[model samples]
Target: MQINQTQSDGLKQAFSVTLPFADLEQKRQARLVELGRTIRLPGFRPGKVPMSLLQKRYGSAVMAEVADESVNEATRQLLSERGLRPAMQPKVDLVSAGEDKDLEFTLELEVLPEIEVPNLGEITLTRLKAEPGDEAITQGLDNLLKSRRKEIEVTEERPAAQGDAVVVDFVGRIDGVAFEGGTAQDVPVELGGAGFIPGFAEGIDGISVGETRTIKVTFPAEYGSAELAGKDAEFEITAKGLKQFETPVADDALATELGFEDLEDLRKFIKDRLQRELDSEARQNIKRQLLDALADRISFAVPPSLSESEFTQIWNRLEEEKKAGRLDDADKDKDEDTLKAEYRAIADRRVRLGLLLAEIGQKNGITVSNEELNRAIFQHSMMYGARQQEALDMFRKNPQAAEFLRGPIFEEKVVDYVLELAKVEDKPVTAEELAAAVAADAEG
Candidate 1:
C-alpha cells in the first residue's frame, strides 16, 4: 500500500493511493471464500462450491466491494497518519483497476481546521437580570382562558349583524366551476371577521334566520389559490342560527374547569411558565454575549476553507433575500464593501465560535445524552402537534434525524461549561436596556 499527496491547499488535501496486485488478490480471494460458504446453487453444495465457479459467478461484484473497502481503509489510514480530520466525506475516484494489475485511486477531502481554543477564563460576558412579572402572567392566563372559551347559541329574533357569528351553509363558485375547499355546510362564520373574503362576510350582516342570499366577493390578488386570485366569486348562503360573544368570568369556577384548583393556582402556573421563558431568554442573551466576547478574545485566523463555506452560505441567503426584496432596511442602504465586511465578519465569528465550542466539548468529555436527546425529540414533536411515540419513531428510524438532535445538546452543554468559568456578570438592567444591548451585539 502506498499513498502520495498530489496537491495541497490551506485546508484541502488531494491524494493518490496505490495498492499492489498481491494485496488486492488476497482481499478478493477472501471475499470469494466467504461468498462461496453462504451461496447455494442447484448443482453446487453451499460450502463445497469450487473457487473457479465462485470467481466466475461473483468476481466482478466482489472486486467492486473490495475496491470500496480499500478506498475507505486507505483514506482512514492516511488521515490517521497525518493527524487530519475531514470536514465532509472524501470524494474518491477509481483511476485504474484490473484483476492482476495494482489498484489506483484519487481521494480529495476538505480537512477540519486546526483550531487552538482560547482560554475560557479570559472571556468576558454580561447576563441580564429579568423575570416575567405578575402582569405578564395574568395576561397570558387571560389569553389561554379566551382561547378555551366556548361560544353558545343566542336565542333572539333579531337579524344577524356585524361582530355576530352566524351559522350558515354556503357554496362558492369560480368562473362557474366549483373548486376544492370552496364550500361549507352549516358553518359558523363571524360577520366582518376578515377571515372570509372582504365582501362575503359583510353580506351576512342583517341576514335573518332561514334566509337565503347570494354574496359576491373578489379574491385578493395574492391569494394562496392562484386560480382564484383577483377573480370574482359568489357564495350562496342560508343562515340557520346566530351567536353572541360571551367571555367566562375570571373566577375560581372558571379556573376549575381549566384543570386547576382555582384562579390563584392558575395564575401561579402562568407565572412559573413565564419565569421559565424569561430565564431561557436570559440564557440565550448571555450565550450570544459570550460568543461575541470569545470571538474578540481569539487571535488566530480561521481556516480559509471553513470561512469560505460559512461566507458562501450567508452570501447565498442574502442574494435570495435581495431577490425577494426582503433585505433588511438597514442592510439595503449599505454599499457592497460595507455589506461584505459586515457579513464576512459575522461568518468569521461564527466559525471561530463553533470551532471553539467543539474543542471545549471534546476536551471536557461532554456528550449528548439520551435524556437530553429525548427532550429535544419531544419538543420538536410538540412543534408539529405530533404524538410522543410517533416523533420518537421518526427519530429512531432515521439515523440522520437522530444525529440532528445531538448537535444542539452538545453545544448547549459546552456553553454552560464555559459560562461556569466565564466572567458573566448579572448586570441588572431594564428590558429596554437588555434589548438594546442584544441588538447592538447583533449589529456588530
Candidate 2:
C-alpha cells in the first residue's frame, strides 16, 4: 500500500491512494478460504470444494468485495494518519481497479477548519431586565376580561356603530367573479375592530339592520392569500342585527370564572407569566450581544462546503418567501447578485459561529444530558396537543427526528455556559424599551 498528497489548499485536501495487486490477491484468497469452510459444491461434500474451482467460481466477486473494503480501509487510515476531520463526506474517484492490477483511487475532501475559542471573560454584554408593573397586570386583566366579554343583542332597530357587533351575510367578488373563502352567511363582525380586511369593518360602520350595501375594498399588498393580494374586490353585505359587548368588571367573580382563586391571585399569575416572557426576551437579547461580540473577536476561515450548504438552505427559504410575496423589505430592493452576496456573507458567519461554539463546548466539556433532551422533546410534543403521544412515539422511533432537537439544546447550553463566564451587566428598562431593543437587534 502507498499514499501521496495530491493537493493542499486552505481547508481542502486531496490524496491518491494505491493498494498493490499482491494485497488484493491476499484478501481475495482469505475471503475464498472463509467461504470454502461453509461451501457445498455439486458432487462434493460440504467444505470439501477444491481451491481452484472455488477461485474460479468466486474470484471476480471476491476481488470486487476486497477492492471496496481496501478503499474504505485506506481512506480511514489516511484520515487517521493525517489527523484530518472532514467537513462532509469525502469524494472517492476510483482511478483504476482491474484483474491482477493495483487498486488506485483519489480522495477529495474539505476538512474542518481549526477554530480558536475566544476568552469568555473578555466578552461584554448587557442583559435588559424588565418586570411587569401593577399597571401592566391591570391591563392584562382588562384584556382577559375583554376576551370573555358577552355580546348583548340590541332590541331597538339601529345602525351599527364603532365598538358594536353586527351580524351580516356577505359575498365577495374579485374582478366580477366570486372567489373561494370570499362568501359567508351569518358572520358576526365587530365594527372598527381588527381581524377584518382593511376598510371592511369601516364599510359596515353605518349599516342599519336589514339594510343591504355593496362595499369596495382593495386587499393589502401583503395579504396572506396570494390570489387576493393587492386586488380590488366588492362585497355585497346584508346587515342582519346589531349587538354590543357587555364588558365584565375585573373583580373576584371574574377571576373565579377564569379558574383563579381571587382577583389578587389572578394578578399575581399574570405578573409572573409576564415576568417569564420578559426574562426570555432578555436572555435572547444578551445572547445575541454575546454572540456578536464573540464573532467580532474571533476570526477563522470556514470550510467552503459548510458555507455553501448553509447558503443553499438560506437561499431556498428566500426563494420560497419570494414566491409567496413575503420577501423582507430590506431584501426587496436588492438585485439577485446583491442578495446572494449579502446572504452568502450571512451563511459564512453562521458556519463560522457554529464552529466556534462547537469548539468552545468541546473544550469546556459542555454536553446536553439525556434528561434535558427528553424534557425538550416532551415540551416539543406538547405543541402537538392531542397528538402529543403520537409525536413522542415518532421521536422514539425515528432517531434522526429526535436528533434534530439535540442541536438546539446543545447550542443553548453552550450559550448558557458562555453567559456564566462573560461579563453580562443587567440593565433595567421598561417592557416597551426592552421590546424596542430586541426589535432593533433583530432588524440589524
> For this target, which candidate reaches the highest TM-score against the unseen true structure?
2
Instruction: Give the per-residue lDDT digits (tens) of candidate 2, residues 59-137.
Output: 9999999999999999999999889999999999999999989999999999998877878898888989999888888
Q: Give the Å shift of residue 80 in candidate 1.
A: 0.6
Q: What does candidate 1's lDDT look like per residue over 1-444, in tens digits? A: 888899897777899999887897899999999888899988987799999988998899898888888878988898899998887678899899987889999999878777777778977777897767667777897788667767878887889876689999988887777877888898888886757767887888899898999888898765656567688988889999998777678889988987899989988888888767667667778888787677777765576667878999999999877765566768979998999999998888888788888988998899888888878887887776647678767888886997787888899999999999988778786655666666776665
- Alpha-carbon runs more than 4 Å astray in model 2: 39-46, 149-157, 174-181, 225-232, 241-249, 253-259
TM-scores for all predictions: 0.76, 0.91
Look at candidate 2 and give me any clashing residue pairs: none
Worst 10 residues of 1 by lDDT: 429-438
| Worst lDDT 10-window in candidate 2 | 221-230
lDDT of each: 0.82, 0.92
Off by over 4 Å in 1: 34-48, 150-243, 299-325, 333-345, 386-389, 431-444
